[model samples]
Target chain A: MFFHKYKYGLLQTIRNKELTFWALGFTIILGTLFYAAFGNVYENDDIFEAIPVAVVENVGDDGFMQLLTELSQGEDKMLVVNKTDREKAEELLGNGDVEAIITVDESIALSINSTSDSISVSIVGSIVNEYNTKSALFEEIAKTNPEKLPQAIEAMNVNIDNVIKEHKLTDAPMNPYTDYFYNLIAMGILFGSTFGMTIAINSQGNLSAIAARKCVSPAKKSMSAIADILAAVTIVFACSVITILYVKYVLGVELGDRLGMYILTALFGSIMSVSLGYAVGSVGSIGEKAKGAILLTVTLLGGFLSGLMSHGMRQIVESKVPFINRVNPAAILTDAFFSLTVYPHYDRYIRSIIGMAVITVICTVAGIIMTRRKKYASL
Target chain B: MQAFNLAFKILKKNLGAVCMYFGIFFTMVILMTKFNPTDAFTTTKLTIAVRDLDNTTASQMLVEWIGENHDVAEADFDNEDEMLASLYYKEYDYAITIDKGFSEKLANGETDGLFTVSTSPVSYTTAFFDSQLSSFVSNVNCYVAGGFDVDEAVSKTAQSVTAAADINSLDGNEESPDAFEYYRFLGFVLVVIMISALSAVLMTMFKKEVLARTYCSTVSDTKYVMQVILACSVIALGIWLFIVAVSMVFDPQTVFSRTGVLIIINSFVYMIITVEISVVIALLVKNRSAVDMCSNVIGLGMGFLCGVFVPSFMMDESVLMVGKFLPAFWYNRALEIATSSYEQIYNAKDFATCIGVQLLFIVTLMAAILVVIRSKRQQKSL
Candidate 1:
């Protein structure tokens, strides 16, 4: 009987070409998107390449010219493009060609007339971040007396390690590629609920269909509701399976926890998501407006709590109104994934289970009530 | 006229469904608009620690000053080990420790005030914490001199001065972004979303028996096709305006002069492209589920891929090239440029290209759907 009902549902869904195309398209696009998004595409290193710089030696000093030559030919440096033209430098900013440009004047240190302190501050701050190197040999000589010159040379080289140490900060390693599985959780909920609601509404409303046939027979309303729920659950289950399999096998998304927890989240998530569809449609007055409002609200709120948007928004939300964070499904799913990555404890893990359960109960009850409501008109 | 008559019936019958969709759009508009665009660039989780062992009045005042400022709002551990542990664990941003001789050294006008602040030297956010330290220093320097003027020489040569960076940033020709630009984006998003939903609605309305029956009737096929487009447009435009009005409530800084006329014209062009996309979906798919499923994949997925979800600027180089091909991408790109510093660069030529691309997609997709409809799927119902 279950197999027969399943076949009927399949036949009913596939008869529509648009629906089939969407199913296939998501399997391709989202499959690829999730695959690509979940994949580790970027592996960042601290090496600089293609540094943009401009040179102008107005003082005509051999030492300054030598410094410029060394900068241009430095092996560790990536100055492939020497943008000496001011017009070209300004154009580069608009074209998104480079993050910044370093323009060197001949009297770079001494010439007060040509200086724009504001431009220097902005330019130098950016330069320090990218280059992470600083040298002022002449300034050091000008400040101190001439008598202790030989000894001071030895002392200056002694403090060279401090200059090297400043740049050394870039090397001490940690995972620079931030994990974004919270986004996956948000996608799952959005996909599951949208898919579930559509199928559930159609399955239930067309009582002349298989579900209605079951309702008229020895099968009770509860049994029929259960069957519909099961069908919806199957949809979410398939969706999660697709997500996990694609995310893990194809996309190489880190599931942090073992497959067991991933499976658990999917099941609980699917159940809640499917029930939400029934709850929405069962209200006897569920319109496209309400569904849209709920879906968008859930997507944004869920996506936000999962740290999908700007980090500031996420931090402010988490550190401030932590209570809302507790109820948010995106936060719960994120916390579950975060649990596997950050902590092995089940405290947050159990909270996800509890939250899914509450959503399940609420949605299930709403569905039951809607199914029990009398239809005033039929097509 | 027949299309309009039947369109009203379809809309009235699906009143519940229509209202739900509108509700969702309005809700999203409200949420997106309420967030302050000003604070989007502000850095997060900044913390400062003042380890004053002597605990004098001056020390307390310095500590209190840090406490009052929102920049150092989350200051944590008082002890060295505690602060270090938190810093390592990434709890606090940075730690500033003032030694016992800090007050005495500063009061004497001596340059030997030994204050050391430890930060994860690698963290890019260290500069943010360092800026707070500069503010503290300049304030103290002025306090000692019986005036608030920080010595100009020290200010110029200092490797890290907060006021210096602030002034530098101010000197640049920073454009003030109007809220209407964001609203225009919201308008584009709504147009696409509604189109997607309508595609699904069209597919679901299809039934095999109904299609076969329609084939046996005397109704002109082109007229029926026209009805679908007409109905979808009427409904979609309603959605577009409702979203616009709802979105506008959150942004009252309306530039309501002649520019409002320009905005209206842009909205008209955008709506035309939306109708075309909707028509393409209507003709391409016949099942309800397929309409929705395909619409989402095309609408939401492409919307994101085409740089709808996150701005295209933050996107990596490789994906950005692919994004340029999408119609929605051009729609957003044009919208962004029109409302940004690129107003001069985004001349009439580029604007024409963006509008041209969307129109081309609509025309091309519609033609393809028509060919498919006539050759194989003629026995259809709408």
Candidate 2:
């Protein structure tokens, strides 16, 4: 009887277009949208690129010209120098071809367009400042101590480029924008609460006609409810796996090497979401539409706080009111995925899994208590 | 007249859901504005973490200089995992550790292996910090070679590095950067709210039983359609006015400015385009869930593809090529022009062209809605 109920439960959920659309189709669509949106975020926005600079040499300054050439030659060059006449340099600055113009005169000066990227402008300003500072230091040394002039010049010439060694903390992909995709998958799984709500509505004798008939049968309500919830969990978990695979393979998102662990977290999250809907549905004899609305509010609002619409929102919440992240199921689920991708150790990932389990246990217990022994007055 | 009243009555029934969506989107706009306040020509100040292993005067001076310039925090040097987590979460933009022999090396005028830094992949902040550090170290070494002791060299280096260059901007005119950003994000809010609210009301009015009853009444088809259009216009105008009024309250200086007025007019035109599109969606999709799906797909799809959520400048050229066909693209393009600086060189012709294209979208969608409505009536008559 339990197997029979579970089979029909799966059939019923598959036939429900709305359930399947939110669970299976929405994530794929939103993930593709995210891919399209963040296509060049890392390459164009986050990474440092060489600043384009146009130089107009009014006076012959061999040292400054040599500096520009050296800076512009290497593969990881700092500047892309365009040595042009003043007329062409101004034109390049006006047309936004270069970030700024460096006119070599008695003193180095910078002219930038007002709309240039602030970081690029700052870098250009720093370059000009460094040159002026070095020139002043050399002049001061030559006048005050002629004996050490050559030694000072030699000391300045020692390549100070590699004085600081960079240590990479993780070999994982460091694209912060991938959090949006993780939140997208969590949203799809949370929408499975609707399936859980359907299960609750079907088990209560007062809510649905089919449930009323089942309540009069010899089958135990607890066994039948367990079978239905198990079926919902199975389907929701399957949809999540499909979405994870699609995001990894089809959309080519980097979700770390722990595919099995990701699937496992999804299963736990699916059970928690379904149980949440069941608890909400079992609260009263409120209509199914109202219950669905309640479930959606929980999922989307939780997602919003967890950085679904705006990236870095979760961090903001964590800084402002940490207790929210501790309770928000969406944040917990997203953190589980984030920890798996970012950290080598599993301590944070295990805590998130435990959080999911705690939510699942609380919701399942509450649902059972609500629907344990209820008699309809007029159904 | 009866059709207009009936349309609003149905809308009243769904007002709770509509307002809920409005509240969510309005909160999003407010949060976005708060988190991403834009300014013209402000230098970037990154948050950095430092661990000074050498307790020498030179190392302390270096740490002090970095602290004065940027937000600095002391890191737990023993815990690599904690530092890595902080970097991954962007709590620290870059982490630096002064080597134990940093002071000794500087005393000997050696410029190698003085410090170590950790950073996420592809961080511009790290590169900028590196340049600043290199400049500082080289100045100190030059002073030390000029026969000054370590303490005098540190003070001299500081004085030399403070000699700033003359920085000038070509264009003198300045506009409010925040106004433009707020309006750029308003495109997303307008699309989602207009479509969701309008579709819900229209779907109820276009139900088969409702249509049958309306057809049998004394009202002519043209009169009924005109009344419905009037109702939709009222709703759309109300939403636009509320949003615009909120902007006025938050930023009256920008909202009352000439460019701000133009942005408001641009949003007005885009609102009409959304209304027509929503009507078409209602005529095509039969059920409530179908309407919800269409609104999500269209709202979020366009929001992402266009410049609503992600800046178009950051998007790939191919993605923008596709976005050019969407109405929000033209809307955003107009907003960008209205807030143009010297780099973009504002042109009146370009701004007019953007608004003109949005008008074209409105006209095209209106025709589509008319065609769909006429076909549905013909099928009913057959």
Candidate 3:
């Protein structure tokens, strides 16, 4: 009897339209939002653009061209400004048009002139500052000892010679792209639909209340458990597919890595949500309170832990309880996307699949235990 | 006053939903601040490429000192051009090239060598390299003064000094933090976006089945409109204060004092913007689902484009320019200037420009709302 009621409850939820609409709507909205939110830190634009520095050389020697050539490469975009002389370079620096100006003194040591106000430019100035340091040291040593100048210049020449031979490495990660909203939408649709479906289950099949009524007639316990699990899984999978499709098509959020992983992760995530819903629905006397509490908890907890709340709160969580980042299913899902995109070798993706799977099982068992414990009052 | 009384009555009648609305907004505030960490720790030796010209004992000692103190990345630079190229591009912060006169110059009792560091982290990077250079130079001077072997004396005299900041203030709370940009004022933006949406969603749910009966009869349209505006304004102001206060709770610097006053003003401007959005949802969309959909369209959509949910850097130039037109973006800009020392670069007067733009949006949106409401009433009367 319990088996029939549980099985029937799952089918009725499948036929519900209102819940389906919300699930899809949320999935699209959340997915798009999520896709935009994460991956933003890395602005994927052209690389190798040099900080535009105005050069003012009293010598006008061709040697400086080598420095300019090495820095700018074939890209004219890097060194956007090359003033004719010091006066122009200084003018541009004073006006803030140029980030920094490199003025070479008669002695070969360089000096960087810029309004000290800009920290980023000042840092750029430091690199220029080093060139001055080199020239000054070279001039001072050669003038005093003369012998060391040839050797030092020779070493510098050799270092320059090796530039092409030596490999330059940049380990900047690939765009750690993710959308908070997409994940939120995906999780919310799964969770919200399942929560909504609990209402459907009660309205359609008074499964728990009717279970005890039929207990006297006769029903196997194992069959009852199977029915409940099957119903919840069916509801989870159906809602997940509709919501996932809406998330993909309408919102245009990037779905990374294996499509199978996304479905699998969301499935377990939904099972947990519904299992919690079932546990709450098992509150016999006042179902509304249970429903409200369950919905509120799912949305708030999911939002808070997963950084759906805001950057400020996310910062606080990361600083104070960084581990909350690990446990959050929404965080797990989003991180998995990032890992696949950025850290192809990162362990987080594997962890997400395993963690969510474990959670699904736990939720399923809890839902079964709570829903089937035979509401003492109903008995 | 009558409008306010009506609004108060409506709100009083619906407290549970109001809390839920407030709860989500508050949670957004908490989440935004929590996401970024304020940590100050030393990273293990950042690889530094060295091109020793002299290769003398003094030069070797200088290189050895660098290896001991910092992770000196052994990079081969056959020439000055290669080293300069790498430093300019940030492959290395500072590079050392020992000039030819090193042994003779040191023997001559003059401390002269060149240390080059980029301008990017001029403060931290310059200070660090400066200290190391000073120590190495002083050791060379000592050896020259006393005819000492460079390596043995330099290593023996070198002291490992660690820097510690006395951040425990009189107020007991630390001001700002190390790596101020790391938290990336962008977090605050995410908080405001989520808050506006959450508040809108929660507020939407307040339009229950029975409000239609009250909305249709007895209450004059003037009273109804006035009451709604009043209720929204009050709720909006209340939410604004709560958000600002919560913002103040973290980032105590620039968040309080005269800056806090600026935040208080901008908070109203922003919350009013949010409340107007919420009001539109309540007036038009009766269904919870519809309300949520509309709110997401305006709140989330605008937030996405306007540098709230995502930083403007990630946005396309055209999209970012469009985002500049939104009141929320300007409002946050006002808050940003008020709360950070960026006010030093672009002061309060500049921030007022953003405020001016935001006001323009409020007026425009309010005007649109008024026009819609007036047209709806005329249609009903006809």
Candidate 4:
């Protein structure tokens, strides 16, 4: 009998494409938009490459030439030195093959393309300026005090291990863009609450004409309510899971290695959202549009607090008024995902799960109580 | 005039939704407009773990220099695993280990003894530390090379480093920092308000039952649309004026400037484009739920693509190319001109071009919506 009600509830949800699209389709579309917007930002920020420079070796200063040669010969080479004639070097600079052309005359000079303000140009310019200043100082010191020459030479020759070591807790590199996707999933879960609200309204006889017939049926109010809630959660969870999979596989967003944990968060989040919607729907005799407006305002406020709009907002919230993170359900969901991805342990992850569980239980109980109490005198 | 009176009545009935829209948009505008991401470059201090194995004056000086800007904690770790775990758990943003003989290497003018470990392979903090250490070493070398004694060189170098100033100017006559902030966010505020007000007003006028009654009236369909458009325009203008008035309370320079007046004009053109789009959306959507979803998707999607949320410079070339087809893109282009300096504003060609493009969008969208409405009406008459 429960399965009978559940099947009909599932069919009802499938038929309501408006609710289905907002819960599932809109999120997938937004996720793809976010992916396209932030896909290459992570790689560009973290990756390093050699800056190419054209060298017009006019005056051969043994000391500066040795330093440049040593810097260019390493695995993590500072510059990709292209030793060429003035004309060829000018051609390279004009063609944008190299960032700038360096002429080693009586003094080190750099000619940068006026059109480009690239990072390589800045780097080459700074290096040239530093070399000019240092070499001039060395020449002055050598002329004044012959004794300090050995110490200066030794300082210049000191080999530094310039390395950037990855101390990752997880194998996945941190992509700052993933926060938007995390928030998208959280918003998707809350959007599922609309379906739950619809179901709750449909089950209670006082809410609508169709629900009046359901209330008069012999299938039992508690049984039907439970069946509706279950079916809505199943459909919402399917939508959430499909969104997660699409974002992960097709869009190639790195959610995390813990697929099971991600699924668990989504499951709890879906139940919590549906229960929240049910509670909202069961209490209000308000219009569906008004109820949806309330839910939107609440969820959007929650998303804003959780850093859906900007990445730094979450950190700002964490720094100030941290209790909001503890209370906001969207934040809790994203925090669960964040902890699983960022932390080596599951302490915060488990806390988030417990928080979501508590919310789900309370909302589900409240919805059930509210719907059961509405025993219509004339229905 | 009667149709307009009817539009005003419909708007009055839906005043609550309009208020909610205003409240949300204002809250978002206030919150986001105040945050300058560039301020974080100078103000944000990451916590770094310091393990000073070398107990020398040079190492102590380095630690002191680091402490001036960062929250430094002394971490004693037994193994690499523990260090990695602490970093991964976000106990510290960075870890720096000063090995023994580090001071001796610096004293000898050698560069190789400091080690930094962090969860992030690439970090600004690490780069900052490297630059600071390099500068210190180079300063010492420079003073010694200039024939100064070791102690004098060290003190002179320290003093020179201390005297560095912070002057970061990108260009001359830059927009008032706060003015630019508000101007950039105006796109989002306008999108939200336009969608909410336009959809609410038009949706009420064209509700299935309401439209049937309206069709039964003495007025022709063309006059009805004209009235609806006029009423929406009044509301749009009111919204724009309110925004301008409120913006003036914060940054009068932007609102009162020559560019500001141009922005106001361009905003009105953009509003016409939004009204037509909203009418089309109201006609297409079956219910209030679909209206909400449609408005959100259009408002946010266009705002994001057109440089309201994310700066246009940061957007992918393909996304930008796609944005060119959106009215918001031209709106943002006009906004760019409005926030620019006198030289750019004086020419006014870009402003005219962007506004012209937005006007073109309004005409096209209006024509399309009219056809859709007329066809639907004919089918209903049959």
Candidate 5:
């Protein structure tokens, strides 16, 4: 009997095309937009190619030539030197073929077309500056102690390595771009709240005409509520899963490797969202439009707190008033995904799942308690 | 005048919907202003964890150097997995391990293979570190090849790479002190589109259901249509004024500034265009649910493609091509001009062109709506 009721409830929800569109279609559209906007951002940041430099060898200095050869002839080459005369180098700069022209005479000098900041040009300029300073230093050192040059070179390399080593600390990579997708999934789940809200409205005797008709039936109010909520959850869960699959496979977003964990988070997230909606619907005496306003405020505010607006908001909340993360359903859903993908352990993920489950139970119980004892004045 | 009064009464009754419009705009403004994009790059500092497995003089020196700009911390962990766990939880932004004989390898002047690491590549620290390493290595390699003594090369290479040029801006004074441009576009577009569209749908829908009752009344059809439009326009105007007032509260100087006044005028023009489009949408869409769906699609789809949420430069060429047909594209173009410093004669011309294009869209959509409504009325009379 419960299965038949649940099946009928599911069909009613599917028939309501506008509600289904908001819960499912709108989410897919927004998800695709997010994917398009932030997809290539991280990959482009991590890769680099050899910087092209126009080197004008005016004096044919053997030492400088050897240095250029050594730096430019390997797999991880610093530069791709374009050996040219002064005239051609100037033309190359004009045509934008090279970043900067290095005039290798007594002192290394850089010539370029404009001061418009280009990373490659800045690098070339720095290289030229370093070489000139080194040339002056080497001249002084050769004069002071000609035999000590070889040992001096080794010492300089060690010091240089030490200097560069200070800032290059890195190990476990985290892509900042993936946070958008995580927040998007969180949003899709929270949208399930709207379904819960409408279900609660339609099932409560006083709130809706349909619920008033059902109230006259032989089945218990709590039993009907359960069946209705179950049907709504099933529909919402399916939509959320489809959104996840679309994002992961169709959009090609890397949503971690653990499919089981993703499914678990989505399930719990949908249940919590629906219960919240149901509670809001049952507890309030307001109309459908008013209930919708409340749902929008709660979900959008929750999304904002969970870093839907900007990526750093989550970190800010975590650092200050972290209890908000513990309570905000949207934040919890996002954190579950964050833990699965970014964290090395399941501790945070488990905590989020448990938190969602607790909220769901509380909301569902409160909703039932509020609606179970109904004395309808109308219908 | 009677029709006008009745329409105004109806609008007053539905002020709840107007508040929903205000709520959306308020949320958007607050979100855009509070969570600044620049904070990620400018304000935050990277925390680096050093795992000096070598424990040599070279490794220690490397760690010390990394400490110069970054907040260096010791990675107190049992093994690689534990160290990575710290990194994953954002305990440290970066982690590095200096290999054994790193000093010996460097002193011997090897081209590569000194360390292993992972880092937040997007951060300014990574770029600074990368360039510094390249410059230093090249200098050392040159000094050695030039026959400089070991002690002299170390001192000279360190002194050689000191930054020679300080960056100076060409148009530094022209730049706005606070980025008001980024904050303005979303609210104006969202509020105008949502309120005007919803009002038209609701009013037209109400009139359709009570067409026979409305005919029984004294007011003529033309006067009744005009009054309904006038009421919606008044409501749209109220929303526009509210937004302008709010913007003034946040940035009084910008709101009263000459450019701010120009932007306000530009927004008003676009608001009218949106109203006309909304009226046309009411004529086309039959049901309330369809109206809601239409509003959402138009609001979000046009908002994105027309550079309401995303900047115009970020949008693809194909998307922009489609967006050109919409009034919002022109609206954003005019906004772009208004927000930017009016330094050139071309800016004034571009502003006029954008406003002109918006007016053209309004005329076209209004014409279409009138034709459709006339045919429907004729069919009803038959």
Candidate 6:
């Protein structure tokens, strides 16, 4: 009887177009939109590129020109120098072609446009200051300590590139913007709570004619309810798997190499979402629409606080009200995925999984307690 | 008049959702204003974490120099994982560790392997910090070669590196930057609330059973449609007025300025465009869930693509090419022009072009709605 009910429950859920659309179709569409929206956001905006600068040589200082040539000569070159006249340089600056212009005269001077890139302008300013300061050091040394002038000049020519070593702690992809996609998947699974609400509404005898008939039937109500919830969880888990695969394969999002763990977390989160909805639905005899609204509020508000709309919102919430992260299912789910991708170990990921499990058990227990041995006053 | 009244009655039922959307908009605006108070051009100051292992005067001076320029947050440098987590969460921009022999290497004029740094992949701030650190070490090397001790060399390099170049601003106008951000984000809020609320009302009024009952009345079809359209316009106008009044309270200076007036006119035009889009969506979708789906997809899709969440300049050219077809893009473009800094002279022609494009979208969406409605009427006749 349990198997029969579970098979029929699966068929009923598949036939429900609204539930399927929210669970599967909406995720696919939103994922595609996210792909289109975040194109090259990290590569174009956050990464450093060579600063474009124009040089206006007033007195034709060989030393400054040599320095410019050296700085602009490598693959990881600092500056893309455009040697030109004052008028041409000013034109480049006005057109935003160059970040700043260097006037190589008695003293190095920089002229930058107000709308120039701040980082590029600062780099160029630092280069000029370094040059002027070194020039002053050399002049002072030549006058005060002529014996050490050669040594000082040689020291100034030392290659400073190897002075600092860049250490990478992990080989994981560090684009923070990818957190949006993780949150998107969590949101998709959280919407499955509506299906859970439907399960609760369908089992209550007062809610529908079919349910009222079932109440009078010989089948045990507990067995049927369990079968219905299991069926709903199966459907939601299937949809989440499809979304995770689509996000990974089609969208080409880097969700880490732990594909099995991701699917596992999605399955766990699916159960939690459906259980939450079941709990909310069983608590009150309110209209299904109101219960659905409550579920949506929980889902969207959780997503918002976990950085669905704004990147870094989760960090803000973590700093301001840490308890929210500890309780928010969406945050926990997203963190599970984030930890899987970023951390080298499974400690944080395990904690998030435990959080999902605790929520699921608590909600499932509350739902059972609410619906058990209840009699309608008038049905 | 009955159709119009019924449309409003349906809207009254959905007032709770509408108010929730408005509440969301207000919260977002307030949060944005509070968090991002300044949008003016300023030098970027990176948050760096440093652990000095050398304990030498030269290493201490280097750490202090970095502290002077950037925000150096204290961290347990012995733990690499905690620092990596900080960098991942963006709490600290870069983490640096001075090697044990940093001062000894510099004193010997050996510039290599003095410090180790960790950063997120492809970070611009890390590169900038690298340049500044290299320059500092080279300046110290120059003094070391000039016969100064390690301590004196470090001090001399510090004083010499402070000689900064002159920076000038060509910005012509000193308009408040916050006004631009407020209006720019308004594009997203407007699209969302207008579509969700207006579509809810129109969907109810255009439901098959309700429309069938309405057709049995004595009212003319064209007159009924016109009255419903007028009702939608009034609702849209009310939402617009409330939003504008809220803006006036938050930023009275921009609301009363000339640019503020232009921004208001621009937003009003965009509101009409959104209403027409909502009508088109309502006519196409079958149910409320479909309406919700369209609202999220269209609202968030446009918000991300049209420079509402991400600035226009930072987005790729290809992505922006697609955004150009959307009305929100033009709306943001106009806001950017109106509140632009002094360097880019605000052109009336450009602002007018943005408004003109939005008007074109209105006309196009209007035609689409008419086509959908006509097809529906034909189906009914069949």
Q: TM-score winner among the candidates?
A: 2
Provide the TM-score for each candidate, comma-separated.
Answer: 0.63, 0.95, 0.62, 0.82, 0.77, 0.93
Give one digit per residue, the lDDT tens place, for model 2 in B229-321.
899989989988988888888778878988787889888998888888888888899888888788888888888888788877678888888
Pairs of colliding residues, candidate 6: B172-B342
Error of 2 at A199 (Å): 0.9
Q: What's model 4's lDDT at A63?
A: 70
Q: lDDT tens string, model 5, B292-351?
A: 666666766667666677666555666778779878878877776776622222278898
| Candidate 4 DockQ, CA atoms | 0.24
lDDT of 2: 0.84
Q: Runs in model 2 with CA error above 4 Å?
A: A375-378, B32-34, B37-39, B173-176, B216-221, B341-343
Q: How well is each residue in A191-282 modelled by candidate 6, as lDDT tens digits?
A: 99988888888888888777787788899999999999999999999999999999999989988999999999999999999999899888
Q: List the residue pairs that clash in candidate 5.
A: A149-B148, A152-B149, A152-B150, A166-B65, A166-B66, A169-B95, A170-B95, A170-B118, A170-B119, A171-B118
In terms of lDDT, the poorest run of 10 residues in model 1 chain A is A159-168
lDDT of each: 0.50, 0.84, 0.51, 0.71, 0.68, 0.84
Q: Candidate 3 lDDT, tens digit per residue, A1-379?
A: 7656676758766565546545555555555545454433423321223466677777665665565666566633334547557677656654555655555545333333312222334334434443444454455455665655555454343322111112222222322133344455446534543543364334322454544454554555446545655576667667676666565566544554455766765665666556555555654455554566666666567666655544334334544686875666566555554444333354656876676666556655655565554534434
lDDT of 6 by residue, B111-201 (tens): 8898888998766777777878888888888888988888888988877776567665554314345567677777888877887789999
TM-score of 2: 0.95
> Which tens-of-lDDT digit does each residue in A205-289 have in candidate 2?
8899988988888988899999999999999999999999999999899999999999999999999999999999898889998
For candidate 6, what is the DockQ?
Answer: 0.57
DockQ of each candidate, alpha-carbon based: 0.10, 0.63, 0.06, 0.24, 0.19, 0.57
Model 5, position A306: C-alpha lDDT score: 82
Candidate 4 per-residue lDDT over residues A1-379, each given as its tens digit? 9999899989998898988898898998888778756776656433445667788889888876776786588776767889999999877765657766777887777675432323445444445545665665567568877787777666654444452233444555556678888899899888999988898888777678889998777777888888888999999999989988898899988877887888888999999999989988887587877788778876888998887876746656865688888878889998888777766678778989988888888888888777775778996
lDDT of 1: 0.50
* Least accurate 10 contiguous residues by lDDT in model 5 chain B: B36-45
Real A-B contacts recovered, model 3 = 0.04
Q: What is the lDDT of residue A317 in candidate 3?
A: 58
